[model samples]
Target: MRMQLETCLAQAGGRSDPRTGSLSTPIHQTATFSHPRLGESTGYDYSRTTNPTRSALEKALAEIDGGARACAFASGMAALDAVVRLVIESKRRRVVCTEDPYGGTIRLLEQFFRPVGVVPVYVDTSDTRAVLRELDAGDVAALVAEIPTNPLMRVADVATLADAAHAAGATMVLDNTFLTPYLFKPLQHGVDIAVYSATKYLSGHNDVVAGAAVCRSEEMGTRLAAIQNAGGGIPGPMDSWLLLRGLKTLAIRMDRQQENAQAIAAFLAGHPRVARVYYPGLAGDPGHERLRRQARGFGGMLSIEVDDPDLVPRALAAVKVFAFAESLGGVESLITFPTVQTHAAMDAAIKDRLGINNRLLRLSIGIENVADLIADLDDALR
Candidate 1:
């Protein structure tokens, strides 16, 4: 039966144990399992390639993404690296990507892929016509998009881009980390691959460090799994178990967090100190309508531009509730200055061009009381 996402998430690892009726999926932390016969196997040979905990996670991810299969990795970057390697095959070295993606991804492509002969072509994927034009100018191996893009919250029509990519003989890879499978799934829109930094909304808490990729077909999934095993960036059984634990409460956390974000975005929009607020949750946001169509909810992530760049430091230092930190999407709220922290790998000129400046601040709204979050920001802005 097609259970709702909430039901699926709540019962993330609720499969009954055959021997013990344990509600949670067993860790199966062993490095290797014993075999009875020399030429026989139990479909459980090594922990690196497969394990009960990781298998459960992989299944959950696939189910949520509506994909054939998924591969878990040590970090979000590792998952992205695997996808880049998977798509840029057989001399198709040129890949088109979102103009503003996670800085780490840009670093991976420029620092690593570029050095090894792979080239990255960046465009505002939200502009469908621009993307179509780029696809027309071929030699593109893959088109990677971060829907509701990092910090900026730009929305793109994934299905339209997927059609363009396919017509141009390129695969479509969607970074669904911002919205996650809870709010959206890229494969449903004809994307070939869906990637996530499971550490964020998927993990819910600020603890686990993990990544995931769901392939539209079993063949792509098998290829990604091989890359994961060969690259040795697989998540440990314990980490997989932690992600399972996080998934149990993901729906509730996201619901509350995005609610708080909507309230805060409203607060900031009216504040005199705010020059601009970038949150798709707001009806006035450029991406609001498209996001509504593509996602169940506008996510908790948003960015703000202060009228005075100088006040950015004051606001950071004054915040009593929001943590002045690097990462985001924990139960605790986090404030990040992406220009220096998250997107430091992006060149200075590109940062300026994209409006990722010192005046801009990114907020990772948590499941805090809506009033408290708004008050905290008001106090900081004052």
Candidate 2:
């Protein structure tokens, strides 16, 4: 029988415990597993390479993303590191990337990949023509795109980008963190690989630190599996268990979070202190129509620019409900000054060019009371 996504979310780990009929997946927290015989194995030899709980989480991620396999990591950056190695291994050293990815990604590229001879060309992916120009220019091995870019909420034509990648003989890697599988499936949109920071929406409570990479085909899956085992950056069994638990309620969490987000975005759009609102959920946002074409929902992430850059600290200090934090997509509403938090590592020149500055604040709306959340922001603005 063909099952729906909502059904799969509730039953993330369908791999039931055969011995005790335990509904929850047990944590196999040992470094090594015992073998019954000298010539036999239990499928899981070492925790580093494989563990029951971790494998179950990987399976659930694969099922949700509609991929052949998923590789779990200790952190999102580690998963991205694996992708970089995978792309470089293809012998095509030149890569094209979206102009603004997470600051951590840019740091990794400049500090690590560039020194090794791999070149990255950055372009505004929201403009299909710009992306196509870069791809057509040649020698591009991969295209790493964030569905709707960080902080800015800029949308790119994923289907079109994937086609361009394929035409250029490059692999298309998508960061689907902003919109989890509940809102969008990048693999179905012709993306070769979809990576996620499971620490966010996948682990909606913000308790687990994990990452995932889902492959569109078995061949790619096998390669990613090799990277997972070889890199030794895999998450522990307990973290994996928590991620699986978080996935079970992903649909519900996102529903409430986004509901709050839409209301807040509407409120901010008309506010006197607000200069600009960056969210696809807004009817007049430049990327609103583009988002509708590729995703099910606009997501709970949004960013705003204050009327005065100097007032940023005042607002950050005054927020009562929204935590002045570094991360997002958790159960608690978070207010981040991207210029100092997420994008501080980015070059000042690029920051000015992209408008990621002191005036900008990114919001990660949670499953909190909409009215209360609004009141909290209202108090801060005053």
Candidate 3:
């Protein structure tokens, strides 16, 4: 039976313990499983290839995203690395991607993939015309987009981009880490692969560094499974169980976080020290209408540009509730300066063009008291 996402998530590992009825998924912490006899198997021979705990998490992830299958990895980069390998397998090895993706992604592509014949192409994915123009050149292997992008909050029309990619004989890969399956499911909107940093919102807490990739088709699922097995970047059983625990509360956490973000975005937009606010949740934001048409909610992320770059350090040092740290998506609010933190590896020119400058501060709103969160920012800006 098809259950609501909330129910599905809440019951992530609920049914995995049919044997002992443990309710919680047990961690099958072992390197290899012994067979009963020769030529016979117990389904799992090696933990690297598969494990009961990880399989349960993978199944939940696939179901939540409405994908054919899912693979869990040690980190978000590992999941992306495996996906990149699949894209580069094409004779046309050129992959088009979002112009301002997470810096770590750019580093992976430039340092690792570029040396091995994989060509990376960057463009403003929210600008359909520009992405279409790049695809028109042909010889494109895949189109990777980070919905609402990182820090900038630029939402792309997924179905339209997916159609264009398919017409050009290219696969569409979406980084759904920000919105996650709770707010948006890229596969349902014609995306062939949905990528995630399960470390963030999917895990909900500021713990467990994990990543996942969900495939839309069985063929792609089989291929990605092979790549996962070869790469051997799978997470341990304990980490997989942690993800399962995180999934159970995803719906609630996301709802409260979005609520807090909407209120905070409004607060930042009207603040004297704030020059610009980049949040799709704001009705006047450029991506607001498009994201509304596609996603269920506006998400919990927003970025602000201070009136003076000098005020950046003051705000960072002044925040009492918000943590001045790296990474996002957790119960505790986080403030990140993208220029030197998340997007430091990106080209300086691209960062300048995208407005990811020293004055810009990215906020990952958490499920805290909305008033407290607002007051904290308000005081920090002062």
Candidate 4:
């Protein structure tokens, strides 16, 4: 019999022995593992290299992504850096990216990697022809995409882009932080590398800051491991253990969150004060058809274009339920203006091209009651 996702979440890496049978994985907080003899160490010589708790988390992650191996890092950027370091052979190279990626990713590419000669070319991935045209140029070392992209909810066909990247001899990397593995698995669709900001959906509580990378092959896994060891951004045992505990309830939390998002999107679509609603779950939305074919379900994020930019502050203040904040994928709903908050670092010209306007509000629907969430939005809009 095949194991269900919820079952995997509850018991994937669990060990229930009498000597160490604890319902929750214990945090192995020691700095080093003991070696009984002069030359024999028990897999972990030092905390920087490995720990039992961290190992357990990595094993769980690899299993979830259907990959050969996984690595945990101190932050999402660190995980991305580890992967990029594997391909940057010179300072004058380029990476192809989607037009609307997470703002921090764009900033990292422009500020850090650009100085080292790795330029990023942003294109509208929704247009397969445009993606093919850019890839055919042969300058791109890798292709990076964020399905259901941050704040915009744009869905990219992972298998199609992965085929293009592989045929061109470039790696296809995806940021799977938004959808999480519960709703979508990139490796099954041909992605060579999948990365995540575990701080978001994986952690599910907004308390821990961690990242992960899953490599399709053992050779790529070894390369990433070397970069992780040399770069030294591995997550501590406690954070890894916390993330592992959070993974146990990922399915339940996401199920409720998606239900709430669907309701909120419908409400916003019919509201007179809203100009437009962007959600992959909406039947006629731009990416709806492609999304239905790829993802198991529409995610818990949506964006609404307000009639007036000035109404944002009033609406935020009036809302008694939704919290006005940054970061997302928590148990509580969050609302923010992407132009001023998440995408502030993006250039004005690029922002205009991507349609991240001043009146666009990004809502991270949480695992709250659907009726309560809609009522709160209604009060705020009024």
Candidate 5:
């Protein structure tokens, strides 16, 4: 029988030994698993291709993402790289992506993929008409989107985009790291492939760096697995174990994190120094209505535009509780200026087009007390 999300979190990958009844899944850290009689062994043969611990994590991920299969990787970029490789065959040479994608993804497409004959086209995915217009042109092999996007908090209509992509004979891939499967399941919304920086919300504690790809069909799963093995970006046994442990508490952690974020977004929205707040949870926000229709919740990420660019350094320095950091989706709150930190390498023109203003600040809300986080922001705004 299918289980509820909370039950899935607690028991999805906990395959206990019939003899011992251990509650937690043990890490199978060996580099290779021996076959008893030349070929008489379970599916696992080597660590590079598979490990018991990693298999557990992959199973859990597949369950969470509602996919036929899932693959785990060393980092989020590795997952993305594998997905991109799947679409970059000799006949299919171009990738259409959101103008406001994560900076690392932008770098991968421009600096790396471009040189290898895979061209990347950036479009404003929020504009459904524009996205459809681009797909009609037909050079695209894959279309990638990040819902309630990184740093910008731009929400795209996944089902709409997926329809457009399918009509154009292109695959639709979504980076669901920001919202996590708890708040949004891209597959149910028509996404063909769902990718996650498992290092983020899935691993919640910020202790592990990992990535995952979940595909709707066994064929896509095999293709992703092939690229993963060829590229050698599979996650280590320890990281897989930690990620599995984190998955157990994902529901509870996200409940608190989402609450903290809503409170903080309210605080920032009314602050005099704040020019604009980007959060789907806020009523009447452009994406709020659409988000209600497509997502389970508004998620835990928010972005604010300060009135002046110069105010950023002062505001960043003034915050007493929130840590100034680059990566996000940790147990502790984090604040960063993307133009200078995460998206520094992106072209200035591209940054402007994506509305990544110099004065914008990205906030990754943690499970901290709402009052305490607000007070810290109140003092910083002063």
Candidate 6:
């Protein structure tokens, strides 16, 4: 019988070891495994190529995302690098991407992919007409979309985008980091590839930094696997084990996180110091209805713009509970000044155009008490 998602997550690495009846998946920490003889071998040879712990983690990820296979990487960027390489190998030199994506993604495309002749085209993916117009130009190899895009929380119509991409002979790659498989499954929405920054929600504690790519088809899975092995960016066995452990509690963490986020978004939306709130959970948000139709939940990320730019630093310093930090998707609530932190690498022109300005603040809500979290923000805004 096929288990439900919550059950699958709760039992992520359980019952894998029949030998000693170990409930936890054992971490196989070694550079290489020994073969019994010249003609025979264990499934794992080099740790770099394969490790028992990583393989188990990968299997769990594939099952969670409903993919043919999943590949683990050292960092989220490394997984994206492998995916880009796969696109390059296919000889489709151009990639259409979501506008206002994570700054690191823009940096990678400009600094790395551009020099190597892979063109990156950025558009507002929420605007399906704009995406279709771009696709009409044609040499596109892949369309990399961030579901409810970074900081802004703008939701895209994934199934519609995927259909357009396929008609244009392109692969649809979705960054499902904001909403993990617990909230949304990209494959079910017609996405060809589902990418994740496992360090965030998947490894909810923020301890392990890892990345994953889940391919919809076995053919794409084989190709991505080749890129992952050749690129040599696989995470260590320990990190993989930690991520697997993290996966076990994904459902509970996400539920509480989103619940807190909804209350906070509502609070911010009505605040005197607040200028705008960008969270799909809010009924007034532009993407709220679309996200409601496409995803299981609105996720725990929200961005707010204060009436005064000076309020940015003051709030960052005054916040009691929310940490003033860089990365997101953890158990602790974080307040980030995108202009200087996560999106600092982004171009000033694009920043202005997208409202990623000095007054803008991104929040990663945690599983904290709703009243306390709201009170903290209210105090900080003052």
Candidate maximizing lDDT: 3
| Residue 346, model 6: Cα distance from true site in angstroms | 1.2
Model 3, 151-260: lDDT tens digits are 89999999999999999999999999999999999999999999999999999899899999999998999899999999999999999999999999999999999999
TM per candidate comes to 0.98, 0.99, 0.99, 0.97, 0.97, 0.99
Off by over 4 Å in 2: none
lDDT values, one for every candidate: 0.91, 0.92, 0.94, 0.88, 0.89, 0.92
Model 4 global lDDT (CA atoms, 0 to 1): 0.88
lDDT of 6 by residue, 1-382 (tens): 9999999999997877889989999998898999999977888789888888999999999999999999999989999989988877769888999998888888889999999999999999999999999999999999999988998999999999999999999999999999999999999999988999998999988788999999999999999998888889999999999999999999999999999999898989899999999999999899999999988999999999999998888889999999998878889998999988888889999999999999999999999899999999999999
Clashing pairs in 1: none
Residue-level lDDT for 346 in candidate 3: 93
Give lDDT: candidate 5, residue 263: 86
TM-score of 4: 0.97
The local lDDT score (0 to 100) that residue 139 gets in candidate 5 is: 79
lDDT ranking of the models: 3, 6, 2, 1, 5, 4
State the lDDT of candidate 5 residue by residue for 47-73, as single tens digits.
989898898889989998889999999
Please tell me which model should have the higher TM-score, number 3 or number 5.
3
Mark the 10 consecutive residues where model 3 has the least summed lDDT: 12-21
- Separately for all candidates shown, the number of backbone clashes (residues 3 or more apart, or on different chains) is 0, 0, 0, 1, 0, 0
Query: What would the per-residue lDDT of candidate 4 be over residues 337-378, giving only the tens digit for each residue?
Result: 898888987998888877898788999999988899999999
Across 155-243, the per-residue lDDT of candidate 1 in tens digits comes to: 99998999999999999999998888888879989999999999998998999899999999999999999999889798999999999
The TM-score that candidate 5 achieves is 0.97
Query: What 10-residue stretch in candidate 6 is worst by lDDT?
Result: 84-93
Candidate 1, after superposition: displacement of residue 302 in Å?
0.5
Model 4 bad stretches (over 4 Å): 16-18, 89-92
